[model samples]
Target chain A: MKGKIRSMAYAARHDGLHAIRPPLMKRIADASAPYLYSAPALILIVAVMLVPLVLGVSYAFRDIQLLNPFSGAFVGLDHFRALSEDQAFFRALRNTLWWTGASVLLQFTFGLILALLLDKPFSGRAIAQALVFLPWAVPSFLAGLNWAWLFNPVVGPLPHWLYRLGLMSQPANILSDPQLAMWGPIVANIWWGIPFFAITLLAALQAIPRDLYEAASIDGAGPVQRFLSITLPFLAPTIAITILLRTVWISNFADLIIVMTNGGPADRTQIVASYIFTQAFKRLDFGYASAIALVLLALLLAYSLLIVILRQWLLSKD
Target chain B: MRAKSTFLTIAHRLAILAYIAFALFPLFWLLKVAVTPNDLLYTEGVRLWPSRASFEHFDFVLRHSSFPVFFRNSLIVSGSTAVIVTVLSSLSGYALSRFRFRGKYWLVTLMLLTQMFPLVMLVAPIFKILSPMGLTNSLTGLVIVYTAFNVPFATFLMQSFFDGIPKDLEEAAMIDGATQFVAFRQIILPLTLPGIAATLGFVFTAAWSELLFSLMLISGNEQATFPVGLLSFVSKFSVDFGQMMAAGVLALIPACLFFLFIQRYLVQGLTAGAVKG
Candidate 1:
């Protein structure tokens, strides 16, 4: 009877007699047709993203001085060699590393902790979550302004208050201090980063089935034990993806640095982004700036490729 | 089951309260300073509140400054960029999320590639290009540059949202005597209100506070966005803390209002693909 009914349904599907028909061939087409329809977006993305990227790569190799305007001379490794001799380039590179390294690690740490804390059910979690996410909503440039003032020494409220509370030796201009300025952006970044990390990890946390936790508990597993055994393993992939994305973002940041220090205190806070800005706009050294930009791009590209590899590795482990 | 769990729950709540306080302290301080009287600003030092409060600074900034001009310019730039980007990205994102054709993989790869580069790197070339077009020192140029820079990321954002929606609704509408564009407009567009709101808010706030391009492109205060205009408060000798902070406080208003207006969408967007809840 089951076979007879199946055969009749199959016949109806093949004949297209029914108003709604589900079949293997139709399902394949349905899945594929959307991809086919996405052609225009694909084209535009290529035009907008690909062409410029490739153009940038080619431009990086040439001696594209602004003085010449229209035509650029092809100079092979000369630009790279020139960059090696440049002290400001080295400072920027070092600063870029520091920015990416510190910001990415802290962002992950804070995001993870917040996500874990917020994962469990609690009263007022909704409001807490919204408040935590608020910083990410504000523009990054505005965030820099807010933090810059907060770190101000005399007229600024923070140092003034700190001194009043007997929390400091004296009024410290955190922004003007070379040692503190880099961290100024880092602090602002971490503040902005908390929400992104919290949201992503929280999603991963919620995906873990209650049954798994219950079973672990029944087996006499402690909270830490259960989390280590099940939660961490399940969350590894999401964490990896999140970190990769954030790393690329943190490295490419230009606004915060610009607004906060302008790579100042004698270029101590200059990251690759700020460095490029100075070289291109401030110094009018377009060729050298392009080279720096290329190098920055290369570093990020490596990270992007690593993300792909990590994703594949994740799938294989699963 | 009752007493021990209740005790633990209270501890958990306390911990969350601490975190919330930490997160909100800056914004609370912003409001606190905005309300604090100018004479009390330095005199009150680090105190959370002043012995006295007034609306004088807000009044002055509103009634007696170039702030209104900056505010109007910002609104125009941000609004135009958001609307233009959303429209462009809507079409492009639709194509990306719903279609398949030649070079699709490459196209996506290219978009991803664009995102990989530091945008500061492109500023020079962009300036060089825009300079000749006579776009510099103009709000239109700022809007165009922002639109260009924001399009790729916004397209990706819109695409993700489009992907969440089932294509069946549009197909169904098409089958029921609607053209593809009509189906997209009437059926699919309504469903994407949340996504549209997210894109608009994101682009608006982005262009609103953008300083680097505005500074590079516009040389004068006449066309300055608020972020650039804020820098004008600084001079060769000293920074005007009162005026700068007041302007900062005023700048916070539109952004706050913007988010407030679109908070519903932002909330929805945060949870879009996360979990069933």
Candidate 2:
């Protein structure tokens, strides 16, 4: 009788174990399948981006002399000290701010204007749209070079014509003038940036329901009144997002300065990017350059995160 | 009702025509300079067309100088970087768009953060890392650097494209005895041709015109890209406008041909499935 009872208990235990095992195995398989999908991309991104970032941050804190890189000493805030006090770095900071602020505002305005103009039905719309978008399609370095050539004092067609036509007393080397040099890059950047805004805003414009406009028209609203009541409100989110993103990008408009000015006329047009280049490559002071980079990075991070947060809030409200 | 709007329509068309002329004038001048004889470049001054036109500058830039070498180098670098970045970004972007993962948020944030830094900052550490690998002063080095810098934004671009695609088609493919990767290649990639074209165009143009890394990495004329080559036109005292503009015009051809080839897909790609993602 005791042997039979013990055998029954053993059989129950084995059945229970078998029943639990399949679900456990299945759960493991299910959870891991998604992970398997994501693992490759995650690994590549980390290898290319995350590792370098962490290394950059760590290197920023260390006092790394090129001559004695192996003997890096941990000097807290020394690099930061050097950057904040540097006159050239400060000029770059100021210039970058102006570049970002002016470019973002004007680009948005022109983009919206162009998008609105294109929104209406017209002949040759496709070709006109393409022509406008051409600047953005070209790489910015090429555009900068083209603009530099256009503004060349002696040989360039634009200035030469102006000089011969007596529009100016002297050949206006726009780049040579401290006041006008920065404008060359500004124009180049604005040209490249406007199309992105135009495309995004145009996409948003197309989404607005026709019924809204119809109803407004029935209420005796003019075209301008309808645009104010209907178009502006609908475009606000896209405009905001576009501005935020553009600000983030235009801040790094270093390539323009590099190709055009090389921060010329005594660092007058130097922005954070060119300044960082000058510090790192020309000066060979990696630590100090890295510090300025950190500051620039911090500015970008704050704006980007703010945008993200704002977007989330807007979405949640929707 | 239709007649009243006809006058307005004609005026609008005329306005657009004017705008088109304004946009294209610069490109016309690039060609104008390319063909203008060197003697006529300055002597004719502001004249729209020179009395004489020749291919002397073009011939000189192409034959007597390093322009062809620069062009070839640019082609190799831009072509390789575009292909490499597009392939990588497509796969990674697909993963990001479709799969829910443990670290997706942080991974994306980190990629954005990488873009946030002025690339000038990364140039030092990049040089440090690539120096040991002997990647500096080579086409491979430029390709690698361009690929690294471009991937994040390319990934974002491609992810947006992938997101625009319907997931049901892929799911149906999976149900019909296809693996995920196979489905991606056979079904999804065909639909992504426009996206692929846009990505290729963007990356190609970017790497083609990049000057900073080229200026830094390459020291010799043989390895120089076009932008750097254009700089050689500038000696200490005088700038060679004819040769430089001639070179610039030649550079514009590949880029123009590239844009012409991709422009159709680029337009469709930008406006594709707007109401969706």
The 0-to-1 C-alpha lDDT of every candidate, in the order given, reads 0.74, 0.74
lDDT for B17 (candidate 1): 76
RMSD after CA superposition, every candidate: 8.8, 4.8
DockQ for each model:
0.29, 0.36
- Expressed as tens digits, the lDDT of each residue in B141-182 for candidate 1 is 888777766776777778888888998999898889886778
Q: Write the per-residue lDDT of candidate 1 for residues A57-94, one digit (tens) a residue.
A: 66677877666666588888888998889898788888
Error of 2 at A137 (Å): 2.3
Q: Given candidate 2, what's the lDDT at residue A205? A: 95
Q: What is the TM-score of chain B alone in each candidate?
A: 0.88, 0.87
Candidate that would win on DockQ: 2
Q: What clash pairs does model 1 have?
A: A35-B99, A35-B100, A36-B100, A37-B99, A37-B100, A38-B99, A38-B100, A161-B46
Tell me how candidate 1 scores on lDDT: 0.74
